[model samples]
Target: MLGIQNLSLFIASGLLLNVIPGPDSLLIMARSATQGWRAGSAAALGVGAGTMMHVLAAAAGLSALLATSAAAFAIVKWVGAAYIVYVGIALLRSKPGKAAAPAALPPQPYRRIFLQGFLTNVLNPKVAIFFLAFVPQFISADAPSKPLALVVLGCVFNFNGMLWCHALAVFTAFASQRMRLKPRVTAWLSRLTGGLFIGLGLKLALSKPN
Candidate 1:
């Protein structure tokens, strides 16, 4: 069983981490800005699903393998970076007019958005490494069931992440409505998001294992 003090600390740490915008958050915001709340929500749910997979992997000690193996880490890192860059390119190529005219553009299937979100996190080795490192800190070595404790803690973290992501989607969706009226603004937003995705991809590619 988790102690109250440990649980409290974990919750605080999780919230603090979630508040700092990362690749997942950026993706959600970009989707919300371009598509709508539905797409953003799908993306957030996808990320949550992916994170849960990491939690399961961590419980099974697979994430630890990723953390320790250079080849495995590199492969996942490159794949993730490539995928992000691909998404950025797709965004850059997207028609600005379509973005400005939400009603005119065909609605994107939520399943596709969800899959993109899932792949983005699942392929990112850094996320796996993060789980491997972060979750164990709050787990007592002498705990009755370490794996169960990890799952519980991971659920708490993921719940916090979902709440934050959904809030971001709602806010971005609201702002997008106003921004969509200005053709120029909508165009610029797409370009900015595309650039952000590309930059994040490059950063991920260049990152060294800690």
Candidate 2:
């Protein structure tokens, strides 16, 4: 178990990190704004699940390979960037319908949304590298159960992330209800989201390994 001092500090740092808007937050907001609460919630869960994979990989020392190998990092980074750009393009191409039509329009399959969210997090090498660097700060090299400690810490981080994401989903969903009534406004929002995604993809693509 983590000592009280470490646990408290980790929680505080995690919350602060989660509050700062990032690609994950943008994805959740976009999904909620465009597709409503269900899609957004699915996205949040997907992101958490993907993050768990990185946490486990970090615990198992797999992320070290990624961190050390330029080829590995580039491959994952490009794939992630491409995928994000693809999604952005798809969003841009979508025809705007009446705001009132969303209710009548069938909801996107939860599985599809979930997968989109999952892939979004999993493909980002930045996330893998983040875990590789961030999780160990709280761990002691002398700890008897280092892997267990990392897992526990990762769980706490993911739990905190889930709460923040869910809250974002709910708030956006509420705002979207009114926004959806305005076709022009909805169209513009979609365009803005699409543009943001493309920008994120470009930024990710251009990032250098630390």
Once superposed on the true structure, which residue ranges of model 1 sit more than 4 Å away at CA? Answer: 2-5, 98-106
- lDDT for predicted candidate 1 compared with the true structure: 0.82
Please write out the lDDT profile of model 1 over residues 1-210, one tens digit for every residue: 652237888898899998887678877887887678888999999999999999999989998888888888888899999998887776666654644375322357899889888988887888888889988988877777788888888899999999999999999989878655565566566667777888889999997668
Task: State each model's C-alpha RMSD to the native.
Answer: 2.1, 2.1
Tens-place lDDT per residue, model 2, 1-210, is 442227788888998988887667877887787778888999899999999999999889888888999999899999999998887776666566665565322357888888888988999989888888888888877777877888888999999999999999999889888654565556666667777888999999998679
Give all candidates' CA lDDT scores: 0.82, 0.82
Candidate 1 TM-score over all chains jointly: 0.92
In model 2, which residue pairs have backbone atoms overlapping below 3 Å? none
Give each model's clash number: 0, 0
